[model samples]
Target: MKSSPIGGDEHPRPLIREVVVINKQGIHARPAALFVKTATKFRADIGIEKEGEVVNGKSIIGLLMLAAGEGTKLTLTAQGQDAEKALAELSKLFEDKFSED
Candidate 1:
């Protein structure tokens, strides 16, 4: 059998990265909204995973549901032509502490 590309596309594999919540407040409403905003800007399909539970990266509610507190590690996945770029930007948000200081 032929192997299929991720997200039903020609992309070899979905870009995956592990990020830790560095913000003091974690992914609360503001951060969730920002995350969703950023994720929506990319054409790639994005998903945020916490302990195996994955949620749509474009959904604010989904992000908020993770309850990803400070220091919590999460996995981010993206599949599409811009998968690499998407993951880069998304992971930057985590590293920047969502700009919440």
Candidate 2:
């Protein structure tokens, strides 16, 4: 889904990426917090989905509800001026297992 425009002459464009949780601990407190922190740095709106349940990427509580353990697949969506960059960083986080063991 597209997000509302930010600056002048800007239009929302949807961007989506899929990743699997490879971290041994999954997306626990620290990783979720890191996800939210990274999401907030972008101008795009972010959402994460697992098994069709979508949640706000910026909310720690929302992410916790998913209980995304290792091997859980998630869809990451972003829309706005910085969507490309945001997706790249977020995807890297998942690919890197949030830097956890």
Candidate 3:
């Protein structure tokens, strides 16, 4: 995992956040595409874990396999440069229901 300091201090600790998918459509197709796009914007290495299965955040296919439906909670982990920012952005994305109604 690529880990960076939360504030550019050089620490190598990874950050984690719990997010729930609340969108009616869950993370399918376009929403998954949007998620992958947002995740790739950061330099940190990000991954999503559901139940016991973990998948790379940068992989659209991996994300789709998650088959996360509404109310499915997921653990988001990030390490490397901008880990905090990555989690924050991702958390916000999830809170926004991936911009879906």
User: Which number leads on lDDT?
Assistant: 2
Put down candidate 3 lDDT per residue, 1-101, tens digits, no spaces. 53333455554777989999999999899989988998999888999999989999999999999999999999999987788889999889889988889
TM-score of 3: 0.88
What TM-score should be assigned to candidate 1? 0.87
Runs of candidate 2 with Cα error greater than 4 angstroms are: 1-9
Question: How many pairs collide in each candidate, listed in order?
Answer: 0, 0, 5
- What does candidate 1's lDDT look like per residue over 1-101, in tens digits? 33335555556578899999989999999999999999999888999999989999999889888999998999999997777889999899988888878
Candidate with the greatest TM-score versus the true structure: 2
Range of the 10 consecutive residues with the lowest summed lDDT in candidate 3: 2-11
Global lDDT for candidate 1? 0.88
Judge candidate 3 at residue 9 and give its lDDT.
53
Order the numbered candidates by TM-score, best leading: 2, 3, 1
For 1-101, candidate 2 gives per-residue lDDT tens digits of: 44446554255668999999999999999999999999999978999999999999999999999999999999999987888899999999998889888
Evaluated at residue 13, the lDDT of candidate 1 is 73
Clashing pairs in 1: none
